[model samples]
Target: MTVLILGLLLFLGAHSVRIVADGWRSRTLARLGEGGWKGAYSVVSLVGFALIIWGFGLARQQPVLVWSPPTAMRHLNALFTLLAFILVAAAYVPRNQIKARLHHPMVLGVKLWAFGHLLATGTLADMVLFGAFLLWAVLDFRAARLRDRAQGTVYPPGTASGTVAAVVVGAVAWAVFALWLHAAWIGVAPLGRTF
Candidate 1:
């Protein structure tokens, strides 16, 4: 639990720099050069993520049951996860309407993903991990939108083809993950519940 908390702090803290201390982050970027800053950021994020995986794994070893979720939550979680994957794909697919409207599809996707997991699983480790991510995503999305407003950022208009492509890509990715990757990597199968 300590390790999990530490990992969350480090990982989320690194992610929050733009939200909490944009000025400081900008200054450091200027001082360190973009490459140096990226290198350091990557290192920290990787270490933090590794710790999160390790700690979460350890915590799962000793299960702590919270409120048992209804069976329907698994199906709902699948739907939420599908949306999350689509939103995530929108974040990368150029000129997608989803990104044009949302402006922060990745963050929204993270929020949905965390939320889905939280709804489906009821355990101390699940709550700690998913709850922290859900909270962080909410805050991060808010901060990012604020920043965008302040900067007068304008996303380009999206084409129908691009939008379709994003959805297709997202669906394929989601299917792949939900079908086997989740079971292989996370030891759980959200889609299997419905299938």
Candidate 2:
């Protein structure tokens, strides 16, 4: 749990610089040069991610149930995950309708993904991990929107083709994750719930 918390702090804190201390991050980037800054960022992020995975695995060894979620919530989680994947894809696919409307599809996707995990899992470690991400996504999304407003940012009109592509890619990715990757990587089969 300590390791998990530390990992979250390092990972989320690194990610929050733009939202909480854009000026400081900008100065650091300028001082270090873009390549140097990115190299450092990547190393930190990787270390933090490794800690998160290791801590999560350790925490799971001694399961601490928080609350048992309703079986129906798992289905809802599946739906939410699908939507989250679509939003994630929208973030990368240019001129997608989702991106045009949301302006921060990736953050929105994180919110949904965290929310879905929160609903599906009921453990202390799960809560800490997913809840922190959910909280961060909410705050960051609001902050990003505020910054966009301050800068008079406007999303361009979206094309149907781009939206279609995003949907297709998202669906395929979601299928892959839901079908095998989740169980293979996380050791839990989302669809094979026995509870």
Question: CA RMSD for every model?
Answer: 1.4, 2.0
Q: Candidate 2, residues 72-116: lDDT per residue as tens digits?
A: 989999999999999999999999898999899999999999999
Model 2: worst 10 consecutive residues (lDDT sum) = 186-195
lDDT of each: 0.92, 0.92
Candidate 1 lDDT by residue in tens digits, 1-195: 989988998899899999889999999999999999999998889889999999999999998999899989999999999999999999999998999999899999999999999999999999999999999999999999898889999889888988999999999999989988888888887776424
| TM-score quality measure for candidate 1 | 0.97
TM-score of each: 0.97, 0.97
Candidate 1 whole-model C-alpha lDDT, 0 to 1: 0.92
lDDT of 1 at 170: 93
